[model samples]
Target: MSEEQREAVLDEALDAAHVDAAFADQLFGVVDALDTSVALRRAVTDPAASEDRRSGLVHALFGPRVGEGVSGFVADAARRRWTTGRTFVEALEREAVRAQLRAADDDGTLEDTEDGLFRFARIVASDRDLRTALSDRVVPLEVRQRLVSDLLAERATPATLALARRAVAARNRTFDQTVEAYVDLAAAQKNRVVATVRVARPMTDEQRQRLRAALSRQAGRDVVVQEVVDPDVVGGVRVELGDEVLEGTVSAKLDEAKRLFD
Candidate 1:
């Protein structure tokens, strides 16, 4: 299926608890069994076959392990029918992302992805050299990937790393989107609302703690925070929680004052 089609399938699963929980469990079972299906697994993973052939193999192999619904969904994936197991794994991985968001009881994992993506955008925007390399289409995937690995070493979690890899692989033209997607995925994993905050300077640990507590109270759940320090704020704090913005800065106050006078 096209990416649009695959996403549509995911949307279908997400829209129905009957799908996300029950059908997803079945998908998980079938993919897991693909390792053992021997003959059918090989065919489903083959690139030469038509979608019909692959779907047929999937039906034959996992019809027993999974329901008719899941087999149909798997067999319908156009990319998996033509691409390597890597793409299939990525699609499954995306489902796992959905599973996590479902488990966290968040709708679509938007806040989480937004927090991560915004931070990545800020990081890329702040560093010209890194941005140039990451966004360069001429840069081989291997090189860009290693750059991410080396940079993220000890800095980002394994989940974050995997997210970056997938995003970069899928959309190499914009690493910023990859970063955002990675963060959203992380939010799903942690079952927390992602709130990325910007400060003129690094926030004291106490300030971060206080912010987290306040956001949690407001959100009625634990909210994960990603701190970003941008000196241009000229000594103010800017907090972005989803679409909500809390601005506390002399500059903002001055701007407001100027607007009032004008």
Candidate 2:
């Protein structure tokens, strides 16, 4: 199935499970099991197997091992059609992130988690050694997870830590990419889009509000502004919402003008 179809399936499971904070650990456990064993992943997600057979495989493997909610989720997931075992595993990971977001929302710290993740991503992006440590495949997974724990122990929420640790375990994406993806998912959970706005200086409250309103209208969704102070912008602002970047900075305009003259 396509990614959109897979997301739809996940949405169905999330709604049915009434996913809460506790489900995050359960989903993590499922992902770990799949990550550690190719056989188990294939057994549960095998397309040639009947849906009932797949459901049975989930029950045989995880029914006694996991909670009722987790078992139900596994069975439901196994019953869905996936193009590959890898995609099935990815579906579980997405569910885990979604559940964690739901839990954060329940605890009234969704925004905190969201901001903490973005801040950590920025920190990693700037620190070459730290990014190398987290992304190093030669390092043991336990060591990487410990590094994440030590860094975020007192500085971040439990949800942020959980998501960060899990991002390292992503099969197909780099650690930073996974964390950014998680941030995007968290923003979507809030029915908002993340707009990274670069400026020469911080905006006043009025300016921030007006900019958010304008971006919201442009994006056709509620916009959450992640402010970055960048002196190189010189003047005006550069707004990045996903792949579409609106570069209104003086430097960009000057470069355009220079190119035209050239």
Candidate 3:
């Protein structure tokens, strides 16, 4: 019910000797199934039902369809307490993305996958038509997925492509938002915090290194910088790390000075 409880369940589900792309795929399949079936979602998260009973229901419904690993994971998750069926489904989805990113990490393409997701998100954010097409439920789901695949096939890693297609589902969020969430998860797979940095110009390798190091020290952890070159920043930099924002941009300073005068 609490965030800690949910995180505990997730950590337990992911605690394995080895996690592969197949495992991630299986989890995604389960998430899709639960998301589409309201009755199934309710059945698994029913408060009146005993934990074992709920877990049994999961095994009965998915045991034959999914592999043992995923079956066990789903059953275990069903046995846990969730605030709502929607939260249960979201937890599964989050774990699926984490597992997929873990696979990319294992394959040494984690950075590529993160960059692909970030770049795709930026592209979608800039193109209104592309965003509409991807997020429009009126369009066939397959068509939207196909469009994503076609756009990223050559540029993205397999993990990135898989996540991009999943983003088209968009569940409760926008397409770009879902991709950004995946990008954050990718950074988490490496035990790094994500810092979205905006600047008037691109940073050189040395500048990037220094900024990353400074952020890492400030956060008390490794930090991955997702740089956005925004001319509106007009010099200096703006760093968004989770809820905290560090603004040193010329525009921000000018705004402050104008406010004082006014």
Candidate 4:
């Protein structure tokens, strides 16, 4: 299916009244089932197979195991055309994460969850030992999950702790990468764009508000600025939003001048 079609399916699924953290966990369970079973994935995603057949297969396998809402959601998704079985599984995973974020939003903890995920990602990135312990497959999954709970249990909201532990699963990505994805999803849930702003010094509240307003105008959407005060930034601010980077730092200008001379 095209990206638009896939997004439509996700929107419809999430519209279910039962779309919450429990439903999200069930969707994740289905994703794990599909990810680990090639035959099951193929059977559900086969283009030649009739939609009824695929839907029936999904209902038969998961209907009893998951909630009625999740079973119906998965069955409906199976009836749709996906580019690949992997893509189908990924769509399910994405829906699961989005559902979790939506629940957090309902509880007014979405911002906390997003900030917690970003902060934890930064922590993991800066600490080699912690990163290794979390990312190393040799370290048991249970151990890694326990470590996540031990570190963030008291400090983070329930949604944040749940997502942080989920990141330890990693699947096809690193732990930090998974956490970053969760942060992005949380931002997207609020219909806002995320801007990672790097600067030499911390910005005052007024400065942050001004920059946020500017970015919101540029992107045509509300912007959430995640500030990173880095000594190397020298002066000015560098904003990273999705694929685009707005660079105005002294170091960036110096590099541009050096390249011109070369």
Candidate 5:
């Protein structure tokens, strides 16, 4: 199935689970099972397989082992059409992250966990060697997990650690991307989208409010602006909302002008 269709399936599954902590752990177990088995991944996600066969495979493997609801959730996922095996797996990881975030939300520590993840991502982004170490496929998964634990042991909440470790364990995404995805999931739980806004200088509260309102209107969803005060920003602010970028910075405009002249 297309990416949109895959997400639609996930949305249904999440909606059914609501705010259950046990469901999240069950979903995480399903993700762990899939991540460890290449043959299993192929069997469930194969485009040529009939939906019945896919659903049967999920039931046969997980029905006796996992909770009934969890098995049903996996079976539902298997019945969906995925464009590729990797896409199916990535969709599963997204659900796992969402599940954990839901648990955090129930505990009232979700905001802290979300901010902690963003801070950790920024830390990883700033260190080239650390980023390489975390994202390197050559590194053993245990080593990477241990590294994450070491770095976050005291600084992060248990939910944050669990989410981060699971992201790395999912093994198909870069550390930065995985953490960012988790952050986005956290934002979604709060009914908002994250818009990275870079400005030459710090904005007043009024400016921040107005910019967020404008972005919310444009995206047709509530937007939470994560402001970055960039010393180099010129002309205006640069807004990054998902894949769409609005580059109103002076440098970008000057570059565009040069291109037009050429």
Candidate 6:
């Protein structure tokens, strides 16, 4: 892949790895309700509208109950750029993740289940045909929801099934995103920042504790770490924090070295 494409993919991977659903949605219902708000969908989606002004309009549009954190993301993104219908998705995703993280906590009991949920999302996202089919707007919401339920039956949580339905009915986003939204919600309920860690081997308790401490400091909150072993990583550890990744694997370093000679 080209550098920009690779970077975008990495960003998505990191963001997906670091965040979860319940937290991502919170007041997100408000953002989704925008189209339902009024004829303003025309004003907000208008290509001619100034980005800053469209953003300002949202403050009066959604109200303080939209809350400060969600408002920050929506307002800022609007001020930054006028998004096309497709690009408007960018701001929504950002708001979702930020809101979710703010709601996460130390117990984070749902971390593993949430991880499983997103893993399923990535699996669906990898299949082009399946991804396209699930995201198709032409399909009736009821049909699409049933289709996803049949596809994931016995595999996804009941809650997950509901989210798939909602994404189709509400967001018009892909199935993968629906799964991701649920995971975000699960994580937010726990009130902790999700950290995906790739280690050369399973981490010892001490190792996990120290790592969590460092990450907690960086994130400004308790950090819940998920451990995955990648022997090919050779040595060191890699941690994904939000859109950033801290890579320290021996294989990665060696590959960098080889690239230098090439």
- The number of the candidate with the highest TM-score is 3
Clashing pairs in 2: none
> Model 2 off-target regions past 4 Å?
234-236, 249-262
Against the unseen true structure, what C-alpha lDDT does each candidate score? 0.61, 0.81, 0.84, 0.83, 0.78, 0.57
| Candidate 6 global TM-score | 0.46
lDDT of 4 by residue, 83-170 (tens): 8898899888888888888888888999988998899888998889999999889989999999999998789988899888988986
Q: Report RMSD (Å) for each prediction in the order shown.
A: 9.3, 4.4, 4.3, 4.4, 5.2, 9.9
lDDT of 5 by residue, 1-262 (tens): 4797779778777767764567777777777788778898999998898999999999999898878887887788888887777678778767767878888888888888988887787788778998888877798988998999999989987778887776676455677787888888899887889987777777878777777777788779998777776767544467778887767534543343223212
Report how far off residue 233 is in candidate 6 (Å): 6.4
- Model 3: per-residue lDDT, tens digit, 1-262? 6956787668666966367889889999999899999998999999899999999999998999988888888898888888888899898888888888888998999999999899899999989999999988999999999999999878889999999999998777898888898988888777888998887688878778877887788789999989898878633567788877766534443343223212
Rank all candidate structures by their lDDT, best first, as comma-separated numbers.
Answer: 3, 4, 2, 5, 1, 6
Give the best candidate by lDDT. Answer: 3
lDDT score, candidate 6, position 137 = 78
Ranking by TM-score: 3, 4, 2, 5, 1, 6
For every model shown, the clashing-pair count is 5, 0, 0, 0, 2, 14
Residue 28, candidate 4: alpha-carbon lDDT: 89
Superposed by TM-score, candidate 6 places the C-alpha of residue 249 at a distance from the truth, in angstroms, of: 4.7
Error of 4 at 56 (Å): 0.9
Give the alpha carbon lDDT tens digit for every residue of 1-262 in model 2.
Answer: 6767877877776866767767778878888888788898888878889999999888888888778888888788889888878778878878889999989988898999999998888888878999999988899989999999999998898899989888776677877778888888889987899988777677878778777887788789999888887888733467778877766534443343223212
lDDT of the structure predicted as candidate 3? 0.84
The C-alpha TM-scores of every prediction are 0.54, 0.90, 0.91, 0.90, 0.80, 0.46
Which residue pairs come into collision in candidate 1?
1-77, 1-78, 112-184, 113-184, 117-180
Error of 2 at 55 (Å): 0.6
Better model by lDDT: candidate 2 vs candidate 6: 2
